[model samples]
Target: MDSVQVRPMQEDDLPSAERASAVTFFEAERSTRRVSDPEAEPRSAAASKQWIDRMRFYLSVDPAGCWIAVDEEAGANRAVGFAISQNRGRLWFLATYGVLPSHQGQGIGKRLLDAALAHADGRPGIFSSSVHPGATRRYRMADFSLHPQMRMVGTVDRSTLPVVDGLQEGQADDFAWMDQLDQDLRVAAHGPDHGYMLDILRLVVCRDGARPGYAYLDDRGRASLLAAAHPETAQKLLWEALASSQGPTLVNCITTPNEWAIDVGLAARLDIGQEGYIAVRGMPVPAPYLASGHFL
Candidate 1:
Protein backbone atom coordinates (compact mmCIF):
# COMPACT_ATOMS: atom_id res chain seq x y z
CA MET A 1 0.00 0.00 0.00
CA ASP A 2 1.24 3.57 -0.74
CA SER A 3 -0.23 4.68 2.62
CA VAL A 4 -2.47 7.03 0.67
CA GLN A 5 -5.12 8.94 2.58
CA VAL A 6 -7.69 11.61 1.84
CA ARG A 7 -9.07 14.40 3.97
CA PRO A 8 -10.76 17.76 4.02
CA MET A 9 -8.52 20.41 2.43
CA GLN A 10 -6.36 22.52 4.74
CA GLU A 11 -5.71 26.19 4.11
CA ASP A 12 -2.07 25.58 5.07
CA ASP A 13 -1.76 23.14 2.20
CA LEU A 14 -2.03 25.77 -0.53
CA PRO A 15 1.65 25.90 -1.55
CA SER A 16 2.16 22.16 -1.86
CA ALA A 17 -1.30 21.82 -3.30
CA GLU A 18 -0.35 24.25 -6.04
CA ARG A 19 2.85 22.36 -6.88
CA ALA A 20 1.24 18.94 -7.13
CA SER A 21 -1.71 20.29 -9.04
CA ALA A 22 0.65 22.06 -11.47
CA VAL A 23 2.77 19.02 -12.19
CA THR A 24 -0.24 16.77 -12.70
CA PHE A 25 -1.97 19.18 -15.07
CA PHE A 26 1.20 19.90 -17.05
CA GLU A 27 2.05 16.31 -17.90
CA ALA A 28 -1.52 15.22 -18.50
CA GLU A 29 -2.02 18.25 -20.69
CA ARG A 30 1.14 17.46 -22.57
CA SER A 31 -0.15 13.95 -23.16
CA THR A 32 -3.41 15.40 -24.40
CA ARG A 33 -1.93 17.89 -26.92
CA ARG A 34 -4.67 20.38 -26.16
CA VAL A 35 -3.22 23.81 -25.73
CA SER A 36 0.22 24.84 -26.87
CA ASP A 37 2.73 24.67 -24.06
CA PRO A 38 4.01 28.03 -22.86
CA GLU A 39 7.25 29.50 -24.20
CA ALA A 40 9.85 27.96 -21.90
CA GLU A 41 10.13 26.10 -18.62
CA PRO A 42 10.57 29.41 -16.79
CA ARG A 43 7.58 30.99 -18.48
CA SER A 44 5.67 27.76 -18.08
CA ALA A 45 6.44 27.82 -14.39
CA ALA A 46 5.12 31.37 -14.15
CA ALA A 47 1.99 30.42 -16.00
CA SER A 48 1.50 27.41 -13.77
CA LYS A 49 1.98 29.57 -10.73
CA GLN A 50 -0.55 32.01 -12.14
CA TRP A 51 -2.97 29.16 -12.75
CA ILE A 52 -2.51 27.72 -9.28
CA ASP A 53 -2.90 31.18 -7.85
CA ARG A 54 -6.14 31.50 -9.73
CA MET A 55 -7.26 28.12 -8.44
CA ARG A 56 -6.61 29.32 -4.93
CA PHE A 57 -8.40 32.60 -5.54
CA TYR A 58 -11.33 30.80 -7.05
CA LEU A 59 -11.30 28.33 -4.19
CA SER A 60 -11.34 31.13 -1.62
CA VAL A 61 -14.29 32.57 -3.44
CA ASP A 62 -15.99 29.17 -3.55
CA PRO A 63 -17.81 29.40 -0.21
CA ALA A 64 -18.51 25.66 -0.42
CA GLY A 65 -16.26 22.59 -0.05
CA CYS A 66 -12.64 21.92 -0.97
CA TRP A 67 -10.46 18.86 -0.32
CA ILE A 68 -7.06 17.26 -0.90
CA ALA A 69 -5.49 13.78 -1.07
CA VAL A 70 -2.27 12.83 0.65
CA ASP A 71 0.16 10.01 1.42
CA GLU A 72 0.01 10.08 5.21
CA GLU A 73 3.26 8.57 6.42
CA ALA A 74 5.47 9.80 3.62
CA GLY A 75 4.84 13.51 4.17
CA ALA A 76 4.33 13.63 0.39
CA ASN A 77 1.21 15.71 1.07
CA ARG A 78 2.00 18.18 -1.66
CA ALA A 79 -1.65 18.30 -2.58
CA VAL A 80 -1.23 15.75 -5.38
CA GLY A 81 -4.91 16.32 -6.11
CA PHE A 82 -7.85 18.45 -5.00
CA ALA A 83 -11.55 19.13 -5.54
CA ILE A 84 -13.80 22.15 -4.97
CA SER A 85 -17.57 22.44 -4.89
CA GLN A 86 -20.14 25.16 -4.35
CA ASN A 87 -23.84 25.45 -3.53
CA ARG A 88 -26.99 26.21 -5.56
CA GLY A 89 -25.57 23.31 -7.60
CA ARG A 90 -21.99 24.05 -8.67
CA LEU A 91 -18.72 22.10 -8.41
CA TRP A 92 -15.50 22.13 -10.36
CA PHE A 93 -12.43 19.86 -10.22
CA LEU A 94 -9.16 21.58 -11.07
CA ALA A 95 -6.78 18.67 -10.68
CA THR A 96 -3.38 17.57 -11.94
CA TYR A 97 -3.39 13.98 -10.80
CA GLY A 98 -1.27 11.03 -11.92
CA VAL A 99 2.21 10.83 -10.49
CA LEU A 100 4.85 12.85 -12.29
CA PRO A 101 6.02 11.36 -15.58
CA SER A 102 8.43 9.12 -13.66
CA HIS A 103 5.75 8.19 -11.12
CA GLN A 104 3.09 7.00 -13.55
CA GLY A 105 1.44 3.56 -13.70
CA GLN A 106 1.60 3.46 -9.94
CA GLY A 107 -2.18 3.88 -9.47
CA ILE A 108 -1.84 7.44 -8.16
CA GLY A 109 -4.16 9.09 -10.64
CA LYS A 110 -6.90 6.50 -10.23
CA ARG A 111 -6.69 6.67 -6.47
CA LEU A 112 -6.87 10.46 -6.47
CA LEU A 113 -9.98 10.45 -8.59
CA ASP A 114 -11.65 7.73 -6.55
CA ALA A 115 -11.10 9.74 -3.42
CA ALA A 116 -12.27 12.94 -5.05
CA LEU A 117 -15.36 11.29 -6.46
CA ALA A 118 -16.12 9.74 -3.12
CA HIS A 119 -16.16 13.25 -1.68
CA ALA A 120 -18.54 14.39 -4.36
CA ASP A 121 -21.45 12.66 -2.61
CA GLY A 122 -23.17 12.46 -6.00
CA ARG A 123 -23.18 16.25 -6.14
CA PRO A 124 -23.39 17.94 -9.55
CA GLY A 125 -20.14 19.20 -11.10
CA ILE A 126 -18.46 20.53 -14.22
CA PHE A 127 -14.82 19.74 -14.93
CA SER A 128 -12.53 22.32 -16.58
CA SER A 129 -9.85 20.98 -18.87
CA SER A 130 -8.74 21.74 -22.36
CA VAL A 131 -10.98 20.47 -25.12
CA HIS A 132 -8.24 18.39 -26.65
CA PRO A 133 -9.57 15.17 -28.15
CA GLY A 134 -7.86 12.82 -25.68
CA ALA A 135 -8.55 14.96 -22.63
CA THR A 136 -12.15 15.37 -23.71
CA ARG A 137 -12.44 11.60 -24.01
CA ARG A 138 -10.91 11.13 -20.58
CA TYR A 139 -13.47 13.46 -19.00
CA ARG A 140 -16.27 11.77 -20.91
CA MET A 141 -15.06 8.39 -19.66
CA ALA A 142 -15.13 9.88 -16.19
CA ASP A 143 -18.85 10.60 -16.85
CA PHE A 144 -18.73 14.36 -17.18
CA SER A 145 -20.85 16.30 -19.69
CA LEU A 146 -19.17 16.54 -23.09
CA HIS A 147 -21.45 19.18 -24.59
CA PRO A 148 -21.88 22.06 -22.12
CA GLN A 149 -20.21 24.90 -23.95
CA MET A 150 -21.96 28.23 -23.29
CA ARG A 151 -23.63 30.07 -26.12
CA MET A 152 -21.14 32.73 -27.25
CA VAL A 153 -22.22 35.45 -29.70
CA GLY A 154 -20.16 37.95 -31.71
CA THR A 155 -20.81 40.88 -34.07
CA VAL A 156 -19.23 44.03 -35.56
CA ASP A 157 -19.64 47.39 -37.37
CA ARG A 158 -21.38 49.97 -35.19
CA SER A 159 -20.59 53.28 -36.84
CA THR A 160 -21.64 55.93 -34.31
CA LEU A 161 -21.81 54.93 -30.65
CA PRO A 162 -20.61 57.14 -27.81
CA VAL A 163 -17.21 56.03 -26.53
CA VAL A 164 -17.25 55.95 -22.71
CA ASP A 165 -14.06 57.66 -21.60
CA GLY A 166 -13.57 56.52 -18.01
CA LEU A 167 -15.85 55.61 -15.10
CA GLN A 168 -14.97 58.65 -12.98
CA GLU A 169 -17.55 61.13 -14.28
CA GLY A 170 -20.73 59.25 -15.07
CA GLN A 171 -23.91 61.05 -13.89
CA ALA A 172 -25.98 60.06 -10.81
CA ASP A 173 -28.70 58.69 -13.05
CA ASP A 174 -26.20 56.26 -14.54
CA PHE A 175 -25.14 55.01 -11.11
CA ALA A 176 -28.75 54.52 -10.03
CA TRP A 177 -29.50 52.66 -13.22
CA MET A 178 -26.48 50.37 -12.70
CA ASP A 179 -27.45 49.62 -9.09
CA GLN A 180 -30.93 48.58 -10.15
CA LEU A 181 -29.50 46.36 -12.83
CA ASP A 182 -27.11 44.69 -10.40
CA GLN A 183 -29.80 43.78 -7.87
CA ASP A 184 -32.03 42.50 -10.62
CA LEU A 185 -29.21 40.36 -11.93
CA ARG A 186 -28.39 38.93 -8.52
CA VAL A 187 -31.91 37.70 -7.90
CA ALA A 188 -31.91 36.16 -11.34
CA ALA A 189 -28.69 34.15 -10.90
CA HIS A 190 -29.17 31.81 -7.97
CA GLY A 191 -25.98 29.75 -8.54
CA PRO A 192 -23.44 28.81 -5.88
CA ASP A 193 -20.89 31.30 -7.12
CA HIS A 194 -23.49 33.88 -7.93
CA GLY A 195 -23.55 35.25 -4.40
CA TYR A 196 -19.99 36.47 -4.70
CA MET A 197 -20.80 38.26 -7.94
CA LEU A 198 -20.91 41.88 -6.76
CA ASP A 199 -17.17 42.39 -7.01
CA ILE A 200 -17.10 41.06 -10.54
CA LEU A 201 -20.56 42.16 -11.54
CA ARG A 202 -20.32 45.87 -10.76
CA LEU A 203 -18.12 47.45 -13.37
CA VAL A 204 -18.15 50.84 -15.08
CA VAL A 205 -16.37 51.09 -18.41
CA CYS A 206 -16.26 54.56 -19.93
CA ARG A 207 -14.86 56.62 -22.77
CA ASP A 208 -12.89 59.86 -22.47
CA GLY A 209 -15.69 62.01 -23.84
CA ALA A 210 -18.98 60.54 -22.60
CA ARG A 211 -21.13 58.42 -20.21
CA PRO A 212 -20.49 54.85 -18.92
CA GLY A 213 -21.63 51.26 -19.45
CA TYR A 214 -22.15 48.82 -16.63
CA ALA A 215 -20.78 45.31 -17.04
CA TYR A 216 -21.73 42.23 -15.01
CA LEU A 217 -19.59 39.08 -15.15
CA ASP A 218 -20.90 35.98 -13.44
CA ASP A 219 -18.89 33.09 -12.00
CA ARG A 220 -18.19 31.80 -15.45
CA GLY A 221 -16.49 34.12 -17.94
CA ARG A 222 -19.75 34.71 -19.76
CA ALA A 223 -20.31 38.48 -19.80
CA SER A 224 -23.23 40.86 -20.23
CA LEU A 225 -23.07 44.32 -21.81
CA LEU A 226 -25.89 46.21 -20.18
CA ALA A 227 -28.22 48.78 -21.66
CA ALA A 228 -26.74 52.14 -20.78
CA ALA A 229 -27.81 55.78 -20.46
CA HIS A 230 -25.88 56.35 -23.62
CA PRO A 231 -26.44 53.93 -26.46
CA GLU A 232 -23.61 55.43 -28.47
CA THR A 233 -21.32 54.93 -25.49
CA ALA A 234 -22.42 51.33 -25.09
CA GLN A 235 -21.85 50.69 -28.74
CA LYS A 236 -18.38 52.18 -28.73
CA LEU A 237 -17.38 50.26 -25.62
CA LEU A 238 -18.63 47.06 -27.20
CA TRP A 239 -16.75 47.82 -30.37
CA GLU A 240 -13.50 48.39 -28.54
CA ALA A 241 -13.77 45.32 -26.31
CA LEU A 242 -14.72 43.14 -29.27
CA ALA A 243 -11.64 44.27 -31.12
CA SER A 244 -9.59 43.39 -28.09
CA SER A 245 -11.07 40.06 -27.05
CA GLN A 246 -10.27 36.54 -28.33
CA GLY A 247 -14.02 36.20 -28.81
CA PRO A 248 -16.63 35.47 -31.09
CA THR A 249 -15.00 39.01 -30.82
CA LEU A 250 -17.48 40.97 -28.62
CA VAL A 251 -18.68 40.49 -25.03
CA ASN A 252 -20.87 37.51 -24.08
CA CYS A 253 -24.07 39.09 -22.77
CA ILE A 254 -26.18 36.05 -21.93
CA THR A 255 -28.20 36.41 -18.73
CA THR A 256 -30.69 34.12 -17.01
CA PRO A 257 -34.17 34.03 -18.51
CA ASN A 258 -35.64 36.58 -16.09
CA GLU A 259 -32.86 38.99 -16.76
CA TRP A 260 -34.37 41.58 -19.07
CA ALA A 261 -30.83 42.48 -20.11
CA ILE A 262 -30.08 38.98 -21.41
CA ASP A 263 -31.47 40.21 -24.68
CA VAL A 264 -28.73 42.83 -24.86
CA GLY A 265 -26.51 40.25 -26.48
CA LEU A 266 -29.02 39.77 -29.24
CA ALA A 267 -29.58 43.50 -29.58
CA ALA A 268 -25.81 43.96 -29.87
CA ARG A 269 -25.90 41.85 -32.99
CA LEU A 270 -23.58 39.36 -31.35
CA ASP A 271 -23.53 36.01 -33.20
CA ILE A 272 -25.03 33.91 -30.47
CA GLY A 273 -23.16 30.62 -30.56
CA GLN A 274 -25.20 27.46 -30.13
CA GLU A 275 -26.66 27.12 -26.63
CA GLY A 276 -24.56 24.81 -24.50
CA TYR A 277 -25.43 23.20 -21.17
CA ILE A 278 -23.04 22.58 -18.33
CA ALA A 279 -22.79 18.88 -17.45
CA VAL A 280 -23.70 18.48 -13.81
CA ARG A 281 -26.35 17.16 -11.41
CA GLY A 282 -26.99 19.98 -8.96
CA MET A 283 -27.43 23.18 -11.00
CA PRO A 284 -31.01 24.21 -10.39
CA VAL A 285 -33.20 24.34 -13.45
CA PRO A 286 -32.31 27.97 -14.12
CA ALA A 287 -34.83 30.60 -13.09
CA PRO A 288 -34.81 33.84 -15.06
CA TYR A 289 -32.17 36.45 -16.05
CA LEU A 290 -29.33 34.25 -14.85
CA ALA A 291 -26.67 35.84 -17.02
CA SER A 292 -23.33 34.26 -16.12
CA GLY A 293 -20.38 36.49 -17.00
CA HIS A 294 -17.16 34.50 -16.74
CA PHE A 295 -15.18 32.28 -14.38
CA LEU A 296 -12.73 34.88 -13.10
Candidate 2:
Protein backbone atom coordinates (compact mmCIF):
# COMPACT_ATOMS: atom_id res chain seq x y z
CA MET A 1 0.00 0.00 0.00
CA ASP A 2 1.24 3.50 -0.78
CA SER A 3 2.04 5.43 2.37
CA VAL A 4 -1.27 6.44 3.99
CA GLN A 5 -1.71 9.89 5.45
CA VAL A 6 -2.82 10.71 9.03
CA ARG A 7 -3.91 14.06 10.37
CA PRO A 8 -5.94 15.83 13.07
CA MET A 9 -9.67 15.96 12.39
CA GLN A 10 -10.71 19.30 10.93
CA GLU A 11 -13.57 21.38 12.35
CA ASP A 12 -15.88 20.79 9.38
CA ASP A 13 -15.33 17.05 9.18
CA LEU A 14 -17.54 15.78 12.03
CA PRO A 15 -20.70 15.49 9.95
CA SER A 16 -19.35 13.08 7.39
CA ALA A 17 -17.21 11.39 10.03
CA GLU A 18 -20.15 10.73 12.31
CA ARG A 19 -22.36 9.60 9.47
CA ALA A 20 -19.75 7.06 8.45
CA SER A 21 -19.49 5.89 12.06
CA ALA A 22 -23.26 5.50 12.36
CA VAL A 23 -23.41 3.45 9.19
CA THR A 24 -20.86 0.91 10.35
CA PHE A 25 -21.85 0.87 14.02
CA PHE A 26 -25.57 0.59 13.36
CA GLU A 27 -24.98 -2.02 10.70
CA ALA A 28 -23.24 -4.41 13.09
CA GLU A 29 -25.09 -7.62 14.10
CA ARG A 30 -25.36 -7.41 17.95
CA SER A 31 -25.00 -3.64 17.97
CA THR A 32 -28.72 -3.81 17.18
CA ARG A 33 -29.95 -2.06 20.31
CA ARG A 34 -27.41 0.40 21.68
CA VAL A 35 -26.18 1.32 18.26
CA SER A 36 -29.57 1.24 16.56
CA ASP A 37 -32.00 1.43 19.48
CA PRO A 38 -33.83 4.70 19.83
CA GLU A 39 -32.06 5.26 23.14
CA ALA A 40 -28.59 4.76 21.73
CA GLU A 41 -26.19 7.04 19.94
CA PRO A 42 -26.57 7.15 16.12
CA ARG A 43 -30.32 7.29 16.69
CA SER A 44 -32.60 10.29 17.20
CA ALA A 45 -31.66 13.96 17.20
CA ALA A 46 -30.53 13.96 20.82
CA ALA A 47 -27.99 11.26 20.09
CA SER A 48 -26.50 13.12 17.16
CA LYS A 49 -26.42 16.33 19.13
CA GLN A 50 -24.71 14.58 21.99
CA TRP A 51 -22.03 13.29 19.67
CA ILE A 52 -21.40 16.78 18.37
CA ASP A 53 -21.41 18.30 21.84
CA ARG A 54 -18.91 15.74 23.08
CA MET A 55 -16.15 16.40 20.56
CA ARG A 56 -14.44 18.78 22.92
CA PHE A 57 -14.91 16.40 25.81
CA TYR A 58 -13.27 13.66 23.79
CA LEU A 59 -10.27 15.81 22.90
CA SER A 60 -9.44 17.34 26.27
CA VAL A 61 -10.46 14.35 28.34
CA ASP A 62 -8.66 11.55 26.51
CA PRO A 63 -4.90 11.65 26.93
CA ALA A 64 -2.64 9.94 24.46
CA GLY A 65 -5.44 9.99 21.86
CA CYS A 66 -6.92 11.35 18.61
CA TRP A 67 -5.88 10.62 15.03
CA ILE A 68 -7.48 10.26 11.60
CA ALA A 69 -6.32 8.09 8.72
CA VAL A 70 -7.04 8.47 5.03
CA ASP A 71 -6.50 6.79 1.71
CA GLU A 72 -4.27 9.18 -0.20
CA GLU A 73 -5.25 7.51 -3.44
CA ALA A 74 -8.93 8.28 -2.93
CA GLY A 75 -8.33 11.92 -1.88
CA ALA A 76 -10.59 10.92 1.01
CA ASN A 77 -8.18 12.07 3.70
CA ARG A 78 -11.00 13.88 5.49
CA ALA A 79 -10.75 11.56 8.44
CA VAL A 80 -12.13 8.53 6.61
CA GLY A 81 -11.23 6.90 9.93
CA PHE A 82 -10.80 8.65 13.27
CA ALA A 83 -10.17 8.05 16.96
CA ILE A 84 -11.77 9.48 20.11
CA SER A 85 -9.66 9.52 23.24
CA GLN A 86 -9.80 11.00 26.73
CA ASN A 87 -6.42 12.08 28.05
CA ARG A 88 -6.64 12.89 31.76
CA GLY A 89 -2.99 12.30 32.59
CA ARG A 90 -3.89 8.62 32.11
CA LEU A 91 -5.03 7.36 28.73
CA TRP A 92 -8.60 6.19 28.11
CA PHE A 93 -10.06 5.33 24.70
CA LEU A 94 -13.50 6.59 23.90
CA ALA A 95 -13.46 4.92 20.50
CA THR A 96 -10.73 4.51 17.97
CA TYR A 97 -10.44 3.82 14.28
CA GLY A 98 -13.97 4.37 12.98
CA VAL A 99 -13.64 3.63 9.27
CA LEU A 100 -16.20 4.01 6.54
CA PRO A 101 -17.36 0.78 4.82
CA SER A 102 -15.43 1.47 1.63
CA HIS A 103 -12.16 1.72 3.55
CA GLN A 104 -12.31 -1.46 5.62
CA GLY A 105 -9.42 -3.99 5.36
CA GLN A 106 -7.60 -1.87 2.81
CA GLY A 107 -4.85 -1.27 5.39
CA ILE A 108 -6.39 2.16 5.95
CA GLY A 109 -7.79 0.95 9.29
CA LYS A 110 -4.41 -0.30 10.46
CA ARG A 111 -2.73 2.84 9.22
CA LEU A 112 -5.11 4.97 11.27
CA LEU A 113 -4.42 2.85 14.34
CA ASP A 114 -0.69 2.69 13.85
CA ALA A 115 -0.74 6.46 13.74
CA ALA A 116 -2.72 6.72 16.99
CA LEU A 117 -0.90 4.02 18.99
CA ALA A 118 2.38 5.29 17.66
CA HIS A 119 1.90 8.27 19.93
CA ALA A 120 1.95 5.93 22.92
CA ASP A 121 5.75 6.44 23.01
CA GLY A 122 6.28 2.81 23.94
CA ARG A 123 5.82 3.10 27.75
CA PRO A 124 2.66 5.17 27.85
CA GLY A 125 -0.65 3.79 29.10
CA ILE A 126 -2.38 1.15 26.97
CA PHE A 127 -4.49 1.71 23.88
CA SER A 128 -7.99 1.30 25.30
CA SER A 129 -11.53 0.89 23.91
CA SER A 130 -14.70 -1.24 24.07
CA VAL A 131 -15.90 -3.30 21.11
CA HIS A 132 -18.77 -5.64 20.30
CA PRO A 133 -18.16 -9.06 18.74
CA GLY A 134 -17.96 -7.79 15.18
CA ALA A 135 -15.15 -5.37 15.97
CA THR A 136 -13.56 -7.82 18.41
CA ARG A 137 -11.52 -9.65 15.83
CA ARG A 138 -10.09 -6.45 14.46
CA TYR A 139 -9.16 -5.20 17.91
CA ARG A 140 -7.52 -8.53 18.73
CA MET A 141 -5.49 -8.38 15.56
CA ALA A 142 -4.08 -5.08 16.76
CA ASP A 143 -2.95 -6.73 20.02
CA PHE A 144 -5.53 -5.23 22.35
CA SER A 145 -6.59 -7.62 25.12
CA LEU A 146 -10.28 -8.38 25.58
CA HIS A 147 -11.52 -7.58 29.05
CA PRO A 148 -14.23 -9.67 30.68
CA GLN A 149 -16.17 -6.58 31.72
CA MET A 150 -19.64 -6.10 30.26
CA ARG A 151 -21.98 -3.12 30.14
CA MET A 152 -25.39 -4.21 31.45
CA VAL A 153 -28.66 -2.29 31.72
CA GLY A 154 -31.39 -3.05 34.25
CA THR A 155 -35.01 -1.98 34.50
CA VAL A 156 -37.52 -1.44 37.31
CA ASP A 157 -41.00 0.00 37.39
CA ARG A 158 -42.12 2.73 39.76
CA SER A 159 -44.29 0.50 41.94
CA THR A 160 -42.12 -2.22 43.48
CA LEU A 161 -40.03 0.19 45.56
CA PRO A 162 -40.60 0.86 49.23
CA VAL A 163 -41.69 4.37 50.17
CA VAL A 164 -38.79 6.80 49.85
CA ASP A 165 -38.62 7.32 53.60
CA GLY A 166 -35.94 10.03 53.53
CA LEU A 167 -34.03 11.32 50.53
CA GLN A 168 -33.22 14.82 51.60
CA GLU A 169 -30.93 16.60 49.14
CA GLY A 170 -28.52 17.40 51.99
CA GLN A 171 -27.07 20.78 52.75
CA ALA A 172 -23.55 21.57 51.54
CA ASP A 173 -22.38 21.69 55.14
CA ASP A 174 -23.39 18.09 55.74
CA PHE A 175 -21.66 17.03 52.55
CA ALA A 176 -18.15 18.12 53.56
CA TRP A 177 -17.46 14.72 55.06
CA MET A 178 -18.80 12.78 52.13
CA ASP A 179 -17.36 15.27 49.69
CA GLN A 180 -13.79 14.99 50.91
CA LEU A 181 -13.97 11.26 51.13
CA ASP A 182 -15.49 11.08 47.68
CA GLN A 183 -12.75 13.22 46.20
CA ASP A 184 -10.05 11.23 47.89
CA LEU A 185 -11.56 7.97 46.76
CA ARG A 186 -11.82 9.24 43.20
CA VAL A 187 -8.32 10.61 42.92
CA ALA A 188 -6.96 7.42 44.44
CA ALA A 189 -8.93 5.31 42.05
CA HIS A 190 -8.73 7.41 38.88
CA GLY A 191 -6.45 10.38 39.36
CA PRO A 192 -7.41 14.06 39.53
CA ASP A 193 -10.18 15.76 37.59
CA HIS A 194 -9.86 19.10 39.41
CA GLY A 195 -13.31 19.67 41.02
CA TYR A 196 -14.63 16.79 38.91
CA MET A 197 -14.06 14.47 41.81
CA LEU A 198 -16.96 16.08 43.64
CA ASP A 199 -19.03 16.61 40.50
CA ILE A 200 -21.81 14.11 41.33
CA LEU A 201 -23.86 15.27 44.30
CA ARG A 202 -26.53 12.59 44.69
CA LEU A 203 -25.59 12.10 48.29
CA VAL A 204 -27.86 13.37 50.99
CA VAL A 205 -28.88 12.06 54.40
CA CYS A 206 -31.69 9.54 53.99
CA ARG A 207 -33.60 8.04 56.88
CA ASP A 208 -36.03 5.16 57.12
CA GLY A 209 -37.11 6.59 60.44
CA ALA A 210 -33.95 5.95 62.53
CA ARG A 211 -31.61 4.44 59.97
CA PRO A 212 -29.51 7.06 58.25
CA GLY A 213 -27.57 6.54 55.02
CA TYR A 214 -26.94 8.26 51.71
CA ALA A 215 -27.72 7.62 48.07
CA TYR A 216 -27.49 9.88 45.04
CA LEU A 217 -27.65 9.61 41.27
CA ASP A 218 -24.38 10.15 39.50
CA ASP A 219 -23.96 12.27 36.39
CA ARG A 220 -24.63 9.48 33.85
CA GLY A 221 -28.10 8.58 35.11
CA ARG A 222 -26.16 5.96 37.04
CA ALA A 223 -26.67 5.85 40.82
CA SER A 224 -24.30 5.64 43.74
CA LEU A 225 -25.02 4.54 47.28
CA LEU A 226 -22.70 5.38 50.13
CA ALA A 227 -22.76 2.76 52.86
CA ALA A 228 -22.26 5.24 55.65
CA ALA A 229 -22.92 2.57 58.22
CA HIS A 230 -24.99 -0.17 56.63
CA PRO A 231 -24.86 -1.98 53.29
CA GLU A 232 -28.63 -2.19 52.83
CA THR A 233 -28.99 1.56 52.99
CA ALA A 234 -27.53 1.97 49.51
CA GLN A 235 -29.72 -0.76 48.11
CA LYS A 236 -32.81 0.70 49.73
CA LEU A 237 -32.04 4.17 48.45
CA LEU A 238 -31.46 3.00 44.88
CA TRP A 239 -34.50 0.70 44.87
CA GLU A 240 -36.65 3.48 46.25
CA ALA A 241 -35.62 6.02 43.63
CA LEU A 242 -35.78 3.47 40.80
CA ALA A 243 -39.29 2.34 41.70
CA SER A 244 -40.48 5.93 41.88
CA SER A 245 -38.94 7.27 38.69
CA GLN A 246 -41.39 7.85 35.81
CA GLY A 247 -42.23 4.91 33.51
CA PRO A 248 -40.38 1.95 32.05
CA THR A 249 -37.69 2.70 34.60
CA LEU A 250 -34.14 1.63 33.86
CA VAL A 251 -30.88 2.34 35.66
CA ASN A 252 -27.33 1.74 34.43
CA CYS A 253 -25.02 0.70 37.26
CA ILE A 254 -21.25 -0.01 37.32
CA THR A 255 -20.14 -2.61 39.80
CA THR A 256 -17.24 -4.93 39.27
CA PRO A 257 -18.09 -7.89 37.00
CA ASN A 258 -21.02 -9.14 39.10
CA GLU A 259 -24.70 -9.48 39.80
CA TRP A 260 -26.68 -6.88 41.62
CA ALA A 261 -26.49 -5.26 38.18
CA ILE A 262 -26.91 -8.56 36.34
CA ASP A 263 -29.62 -9.89 38.63
CA VAL A 264 -31.41 -6.57 38.61
CA GLY A 265 -31.83 -6.92 34.87
CA LEU A 266 -33.11 -10.46 35.31
CA ALA A 267 -35.52 -9.46 38.06
CA ALA A 268 -36.78 -6.33 36.37
CA ARG A 269 -37.58 -8.47 33.34
CA LEU A 270 -35.48 -6.34 30.99
CA ASP A 271 -33.68 -8.05 28.13
CA ILE A 272 -29.99 -8.63 28.80
CA GLY A 273 -27.83 -7.77 25.84
CA GLN A 274 -24.03 -7.82 25.95
CA GLU A 275 -23.14 -4.51 24.43
CA GLY A 276 -20.35 -5.14 21.86
CA TYR A 277 -18.36 -2.76 24.01
CA ILE A 278 -15.29 -4.21 25.71
CA ALA A 279 -13.18 -1.91 27.84
CA VAL A 280 -9.46 -2.14 27.02
CA ARG A 281 -7.23 -1.20 29.94
CA GLY A 282 -3.54 -1.95 29.72
CA MET A 283 -3.06 -2.71 33.40
CA PRO A 284 -5.16 -0.16 35.32
CA VAL A 285 -8.47 1.22 34.12
CA PRO A 286 -9.42 4.70 35.23
CA ALA A 287 -12.78 5.24 36.88
CA PRO A 288 -15.16 6.89 34.41
CA TYR A 289 -17.66 6.17 37.20
CA LEU A 290 -16.73 9.28 39.19
CA ALA A 291 -17.98 11.08 36.14
CA SER A 292 -20.90 9.10 34.70
CA GLY A 293 -20.61 9.60 30.94
CA HIS A 294 -16.99 8.44 31.18
CA PHE A 295 -16.25 6.68 27.89
CA LEU A 296 -12.50 7.02 27.57
Candidate that scores best on lDDT: 2
Q: In model 2, what is the error at residue 236, expressed in angstroms? A: 5.5
Candidate 1, which segments miss by more than 4 Å at Cα? Answer: 34-64, 72-75, 89-107, 114-120, 132-138, 148-240, 243-278, 281-296
Candidate 2 Cα errors over 4 Å, as ranges: 1-4, 29-42, 60-64, 72-77, 120-134, 148-155, 163-241, 249-256, 263-271, 284-296
Q: In terms of TM-score, how similar is model 2 to the real structure?
A: 0.63
* Cα lDDT of model 2 by residue, 136-212, tens digit: 66677766665544444545643444564556665444554444443332322223332332453444456443444
Candidate 2 contains a number of clashing pairs equal to 13
Per-prediction count of colliding residue pairs? 29, 13
TM-score per candidate: 0.50, 0.63
